[model samples]
Structure formats: C-alpha cells, structure tokens
Target: MPEPATRIRPMGRRAVLTGGAAAILAAAGFTPAQAATGRSAGKATGEPTYTLTVMGTTDLHGNVFNWDYFGDKEFDDTQHDDIGLAKIATLVDAVRAERGRRNTLLIDAGDTIQGTPLAYYYARVEPITKQRIHPMAAAMNAIGFDAAALGNHEFNYGIPLLRTFEKQLDFPLLGANAVDQRTGQPAFAPYTVRTVRFEGARPLKVGILGLTNPGIAIWDKANVEGQMTFPGLVEQARVFVPRLRRAGADIVVVSAHSGADTSSSYGDALPYPENASTLLAEEVPGIDAVLVGHAHAEIPQRFVTNKETGAQVLLTEPSYWGRRLSLIDLDVRWSGRQGWQVVAKRSQVLKSNTVPEDTEIVALLKGDHDKVVTYVNSPVGTSKEAMSAATARYEDVPALDFVNFVQAKAVKDALAGTADAELPVLSIAAPFNRDAAIPAGQVSVRDVAGLYIYDNTLLAVRFTGAQLKDYLELSATYFKQVTGSGPFAPDDVTNAPTPTAPSGTPDYNYDVVSGLDAPLTYDIDITKAPGQRITGLAYGGAPVGADQVFALAVNNYRQSGGGNFPHVSTAEVIYNRQVEIRQLLIDWVSAAGEIDPVAFSSVDWRLVADGTPVVIEG
Candidate 1:
C-alpha cells in the first residue's frame, strides 16, 4: 500500500488572532491570504465534530535496522526483542490506515541522530554534509513526519553539522525555547500549524510547539554556549501556547524533548529544569497533549490537571530506539461558545515488533549500511592476548585498562604545555557493555567500538584527595551486602532493576581507577554501607591524604554530572575537546602498532565480602 500523504502549512502571514473567539483558518490548498480572509472553500464554519490521532516517536538513536553493526548480528536485548525504525514504520502505516490518513499526524520528539555505528559512520567517517541526504532524514521523510522537536544530544557534533542535518529534513525542526544569544529570537521555528479537514466537518487546526531540555547549555556548552540559549520547558511552553491559541489552533500539542520526571535539577538555583514534562503539563493552559522524550523511558499515558483551570492535559512517551509507538486519540466537538473542545480521549503504546520491518527503508539505505559494515570489520590493530569485560563488574579487566591507557595518554598529550602538565594524573572508566569481548589476534574497529559504546569525549579535571576517595566510595556502592558466608551470584552485585531507585550499582557506574602503582591497590567490602564500601585506599605506597591534589582523566558526561557523581562536575577543568573516546581508542591502537596486554594492564581492584573471596562466575 502507498504511504499516506501529509500536509503541514506554516503560519506565515495569517492575521494575528488574540481574542478567545478568533479562530485560525487552514485547509489543504489554501493560501495564507485566503486563510486570513476566511474565504477558503473548506474552512471550519458551523457546529461540526471529528477525531484526531496523534502519533509520536522519540529517542531514535540512529537504529535504522534490527542489525547491530558493532556485534555483526541482529539487535537483541534478551528481554524485549523489538527495536529500530524499520519496526516503527510498520506500526505507523497500520495506525494511519486504521484512522483516516488525513486525520492522523506523525511527530517525533528528538534525539534522532548520532548513536549507532550507522549514524557515527555517516557523521564522522563519511559526513552527510558532503552527501545529498542523511539516512535519518531519508527514513523520517519516507515515513512522512509532520514536525519534530530538538534534543540535547543533537548539539553534540556542533551547529554546522546540525544545520546541514536540518536542511535535509522534509519536516520543520522546531525548538521554540532555543533562542539566539544576541537577538533573543527562536533559532528554529517555535511551532508548526497542521490544518486537518474532515469529510463534512469544520477544519481542525493543530499547533505543535517544540521544547527541548535546558541541560544542552551545560552538556553541549562548547557547541551551543554562546551561539544559542535554552530556557526552561515550562517557561517556553507558557509563552508559545497562548500564541498558538491566538493563531487559531483549536488543540495544541507540545513536542517536548524533556522527560516526564517532575524533579527539578536546578531546584530554584536556575529557572530551567532538566526534566519537566509533568510540570509543564500541569502548568500550561492551552496544551491538549504532550509528547515527551530524552529520559529514554516508556510512559503510555499520563494526565495532569492544571491547578487553576482544572483542565486535563494528556502526555505520552514512547520508549527509546524505536521500540514502541505512542498514540493519542482525541474526540472533539464544535461548540458555539468555545469553538472546539475535546470531549473524550484515549491512548495506547503499541509494540514495534508487532509488524515486519519495512523493506522500503532497508533498501533505501543499503549502500550506507554496507559501507559501515566494511568499516567496522576492517582490522585496525593486533591483540597479544584475549580481553573481555565479562568479569569487569566484580574485578578489573584488560578491556577497561586499555581504555584507561588511551584516556590518560590523551589527557597527557592535551595538557603537554599547560600549567597542570606536571600534576599526578589518574584516569577513571567503566565497562559500558558487559558482553563486549576481544579474542587474541587481529582486532577490528568493531571490537574497540563495542568496548566504548557511548559517544563521550575526554576531560581533565582537578580533584582533591578527599574528592577522589569519595568518588571511589560512590563507585563501590554497586555491590549488595552479603550477610553470611555463601557463594555470591553475579546478579547480587547488580543494581536494583528499577531505574529510579537502583540498588547496588550499574555496570556503567562502576569506576576503575588507573595510574596508581603497586602497594596502592584497593579492595571493596560489600558488607559495609554504600558510603563506607571502599577500604585501604593508597597512592605511591602511602595512604592518600585528604589534602593531596591530583589531575583526573574523565569523560564529558561524568564531568557534567550525568550520573550524579560527587564533586566531579564542579572540579576545575583543565583539558576538553570535541574528540570522542572511541575515536581516540582507534587512533591510539593504530599508532601503537601492536597491543601487548601485559604492558599497560593491571588488577588494582577486587570485590571481597568480609575478608572472604567472592567467586565471580561468567
């Protein structure tokens, strides 16, 4: 079956309607002048009713297929099997077919680009700027997206690349809260107007206002610090919702790249909250529905009532990586007094694996996929011995040591001539992917990429001895307390499955400290409380003093307070660049000629339960 056609009319020169009675007129094939004059042939007039289905997808981190290029296999997480845009395409078609094509609107809530090997290959290896179209733009265009909001990760590669990406998209990339530093005007269009015409009912004008997380200011400060400013999500929505209503929108939908968490990171210290979907829905007046993202969570539906007006606002979030599709169904009736009001509403989260992968999307990007597969398969270096992260959570592994070596070397090179060059340096890292392994012999780009799966840049920060000890203690909390002498299971040390109240520690939060010599090795006792888990910490054959100072090699995410690590974000930064750690690994491996596991590897940390050996079975 052919894809449904979508029409998105920009509100260019329509008469500004400020009063409650004033309505914006928009329909297919209607010009701005005709809409403003209210003379369009199919304009909404008398009492009429209709249904509108709003479909949303968010946090599609460049998973175009079910294939995992790094692992060279189909994507599977063991628990839930569905993933990628090809799966999402099937659901989109089904929903559009069930509802009238003209009444269904598709929207995306950001984090669209820059995650998988496919996206990274296009962005770094073969830039999309040189190519005609980005794979993301091509896929989204083929799927007929009406509008999209911006996410914080979108600014990681810099504004030039983001501009190139925006130009290739068929839909409007809206970020109403992202304002220019000098002009204070929206850098991107604040909102988009979609005019829907039912068979015999009045035209329904839906306005989509886009709001992104304000953490972009801190996370991507290098790229967007002075160029653009991000205000609070609720603050921006308050300003645009009224304007959208004034412009004749009967229903307003907010495409918020912020998550549904109501907690405020700034806590009155700053006006902008990092995650504020719940707050926005409760505070904003004119919004009918909100599409939330950026936390990578699944929330089918949540209704928040405005305190003053007592009006209900519906919110929905589809899980990340195109695993699910969020649908919001609205039944509206035309009232002579209020124009159009939603009388009934329903929502559902559809699984992406319910349908087959869209062959059209797979065929459209075949050349790009093949190029990435070749690039990741090509050998870059040789490993003298096999390395694996299987036991990394319980003890140190060579895979993590290799990463630390690269990070420390990069920091040393970056601070070569700086004042802090002579300071003692310690590098910290975590095993991101537990299943990652490297066999002895030729090592390909895929092996290295799998080891460091995240897109994190290197950073050098100054930390006092006390802060370093605190950091290690925080890392030790990943292990659960063992009451009696018994064989410990692997899952016991793992964090609580609930993300908000994680128990022990996550593999990503387990820090392995390098640059410490013999006699300085430390052990973690899981029987103690979280803050007192670290024992016998020493450096250079002596106990680490609280007043001692050291330079730490870390990632941008940790340095920016991503996991709520202690004192790292406030530390004095000495070196930072746009370079990614994975790329550095590739460069370091290529320059070293050969990697002998014994040269830079060390077993400096281990997990023990009350002076007893803890068996780690992998």
Candidate 2:
C-alpha cells in the first residue's frame, strides 16, 4: 500500500503551481520533487519565483501579557487557555524564522487599546496623553508591526489619546476612511507601500490600505462629532485601490478593521455598512488579499470572486485577543507579460497556545501590569451577601436590580426641577456578563467593572406606553420557544437565530425593569412567538394606554438603537448625562457602604409555558 498523499497547501515554498496543476498533482501520482525536476516541461520561465508571507493580529484590546486583570490570573475560558501579545510575539518569531525574516511582514487590524481593565487603567487612571509611551504602542513596537488599521473602539478614548498613541508607534497607522470633518480628506495615513526583494531579485512593492468600521460615528458620537468623519469602506477602497496600483504596487493587501459580514444591524442608520469586508473584497479590484477583524470571528481562509473581473481575493481573520495568527502566503514570479503576479496562495489561522509566550514582553510591561492590578483590587464598597449574575437570565435576580436602582435614581435626581419629573420612570438593566459577581465580604472596583463591562453613559429618553411595551416585547425574544412547563435545563433554552451566540440567550439582551408598581405584573410565555411572548403587560393595575408617556432610563448604547431595540433612537431625550453607569454604581455603593436588597430588589416578572408557571434553578 502507498502512503497517503500530503495536502499540497503552500508553506513558505518558492515553487509556483497553477490552479489546474495543483488539483491534478495528487491524482496523477506526481510529487513535488518531480515538478521541480520537470519545471521546464510545462512552460518557458525567465526568472525564479519568490514566496511572500504576511502575518496579522487583530482586536488585541490592550492585552500584552496573557493575564486577565478582572480575574487577576492567566486568561482562560475552560476549553481554550490562550490570549495576549506575548503568545503572538512567539508565533511571529517562529514564522519569521521559517520564512526568511526579509520576506515576512506583520500587521495588526486595530482595536488594540481598549478592552480590559489594563487598557482602562492606562487611558483613564494614568493618562497616556502625556509623553509616556502607551503600553499597546510599546508592545506592538516590540513585535515590529509594519502597519495597522483603526478600530471603532480606538475612538472611545477620543482622538488626542489615539493621536498620542499613534505618535509613539514606529509604523504608519492606516485608516483610509477615517476622514477630517473640515477637509473630507483622510485624517490618518490612508495606505503605506513597502518595497522588498527576495533572493536579491527585483524589488516588489506591496501596498496596504486600512479601512475602519462605520459604526464608529454612532458609537463614539461625542468624541468624534465635529472632529472626524468615517466614510464607507467600499467608497474609500474604490478611491485608494486605483491610487495604490498606479503607485507601482505589485501586491495590494487590505487590513480592514471590519467584519466579514455585509449585513448591518443598524439598517439605514448609517449610509454605509458597519461590517463591509466581504463587500470590499467582492466589489473592489486589484486587491490580492484582505485581513479582516473587529468582529472577533475565526475565519481561517475565505476566497471571494470579484463580480466585474472574476479575480480571486484571499481573506483571513484570526480569532480576537491574540488567540490566533492569520497567515497568508503568496508565490509570485515574473510573468513575461504581467510582470510579478501571484501564481499560488495559501492561508491558515495558527493557535497561540501552540507556542510559548515571549519572555521579553512580560518583562517590558511588568510595571504597568502591576499598577493595574493594584488599581482593580482596591476596595470600593461592601456586600452583605454574595450576589451572582449567573442566574440573571433565568430569574428576577437582585444582581441586575442593583444596577437598575442606581440608574433610575440618578435620572430622577437630574430631572427633579423639570416637567419630566412628573412622568412615570422605568429603569432598564442587562446582565452584561454571566461570571460577574460580588463576594460576601467586600466589593472592589473590578467587581463593578466586571458587572458593567462596557463604557456606556446614562440617558433618560421619553417614550410612549406603546413604545415601552414594544421594547419589552423585543427583549422577550431572548427566550426560546418552550412546550411543557416541567423542569428543564436553562442552558437548553437558547433560541438564537445563529448557533455561534452564547447559550440560554445573550445576557446583554435580557433586560429587566425596575419601577413598575403592583398588579402591573407581566409574564413571558416562552411557548409563543417573539412578538407575542409578553402577556398581561399593564400599568397602575390596568392595560397600559398607548398615549401614556414615561421617562425610560437606559444606557447610551441602547438609546443609539443598539441591540435592535424598538423606538429607542427615535424617542425624545428628556435627560442626558456624561456620567458612566459603572462609575455611578461605584459611587452609590461607596456612599452607602453596603448593598441593601430591600431598597430595590423585587420580583415583578416571571415565565410561563403551556399555562404552567416555569421554575428555574438559581
């Protein structure tokens, strides 16, 4: 018996294979050795081909070490125990060693400076706007990144910090679509061209264009309102791609900080798509490959054929948080007519745990990491009992009510002297993280940060009673359709449209109300369709009138129509504050010195299926 044929995927190989030849090689029992010996038999060749390797990292989110500051330990999700730039630096070194360092290039697809507590500590607690080199900048510089794209989260801390962080980087930060409001020209370097030669042959020019997400305009409206404008990805690609080719670039690659999906959750909210990487590759011409991110999805390799030219564009997106590295290898040779053209290509996403973390990175950022550790561990308040958010999605728990109480009280206090004070107020809260909890003994800043992971501000919007009912109905869609009321696993109650979502509905979408009075109770029937799930929605012991108006307390993300909530963005704003909800919670707890469940915690909602009340385990 003959040994099984090896997969012909290219890995730092200089040999060029036509699409037809690669497919026929295995079936014809032809080996790579035979191809090398009989190279001249196929066609006339003038020069030898060269192999070019491109590596990429995205959504690093300020994670330099493999440590999770929230848990104060090495990052782990039970199944996959890997994260951060230390692991990526190790992988980059291995790839550079395998494929000559001169022939390799490294790039990051943004979202580098704002996810963990470490990032927050640097940006807010210790302002990096000064001359100090940002941790992300220092780490990326150590890894030798050639270029990067701007992610939407990059604007969360405003442009001054972003610009300061950019000045410290050795490479050009690319963002073709991030434009200036006054001039409408690219605010940052739109593209960068790097020239390199392999085997001391003729130099090849590689042009890289970076495109950011359009959702930045909505998400970071306050920070970038009059300073920066974000245009569509496809629009900017059409303009820059031609310029790149005219600039004599042999290979044109795009490092798009956008997702692979073309669909926008905020339909018609923005003129362009928020996640338009697939569209850019399919519509634009002369792009050889694309590195996608900002969606945190794992796409090892995808090939999209251009509609007009029928040319193939290779794409790869490694998983977020430095867990994986997206690698693309292209074999280019001097085509007598077309000059240097890519004859063959291959791509893969390498896991971070396969290699050990680089020790140099751990040593370089140890001081900053230690400071962040001290910042998070500092006590904020005390908790009477251990409050866990694990059951927030399954039951009416005090863990979420605690947040709702703070938000509602803040809004009422702000609207004290205004006409909106007389209106009924309902505060909305979501269980952002399932693992969020406060120990029985004490509560720290990290505990509150874990509970409200995002940097969202508070907003009090005025809504009609009909719109309020619509909001609850939309949230009711989180529950899965059920039949029998018998005991069943809560984990098995997920009914998301896609399988990739978290089980038992996403905690971010399971919102709870905090100000409804008695006999105004409502029950969600898991057995019914989404729109009809919420039954017996009432106010003041009667069915809520459509004309009745009220003030709804919610975060800015939802007020900007996040989570696809109904009529949120269209509602009139009665009160708006720059105060972050997390900060408010910390202040409220600190002033009281302890959490009192009797102050706000109560059960006003329940679940029913088949006319039988459903009981869930706590």
Q: Going through the candidates in order, what is the number of backbone clashes in each?
A: 4, 0
Candidate 1 local lDDT, 1-618, one digit each (tens): 111122454322111122211111111111222112111232354444467888899999888888888789888787546788877776676555445577778899999887898888877888887466788898888878889999888887789888999999878898988888988888988888888776666788899999988888777777887899999998888888998888888889999999887654333434677889989988888888999999788887788887768988888999899988887877787766877777656666777664567777788888878888999999999889999998877778888888888888888877779898887778998989888887799989998889999888889899888998899987776667776434667786656333333332467877878873232467788777778877777776578899888889998878877666788888999988868999999888788867887888877777777867567664
C-alpha RMSD for every candidate: 8.5, 8.1
Candidate closest to the true structure, highest TM-score: 2
**Would you list the C-alpha lDDT of every candidate in the order shown?**
0.78, 0.79
Per-residue error (Å), model 2, residue 561: 2.2
- Runs in model 2 with CA error above 4 Å? 1-46, 498-505, 516-520, 539-542
Clashing pairs in 2: none
Determine which window of 10 residues in candidate 1 has minimal summed lDDT.
Answer: 21-30
Structural similarity to truth (TM-score) of each candidate:
0.89, 0.90
Error of 2 at 482 (Å): 1.3
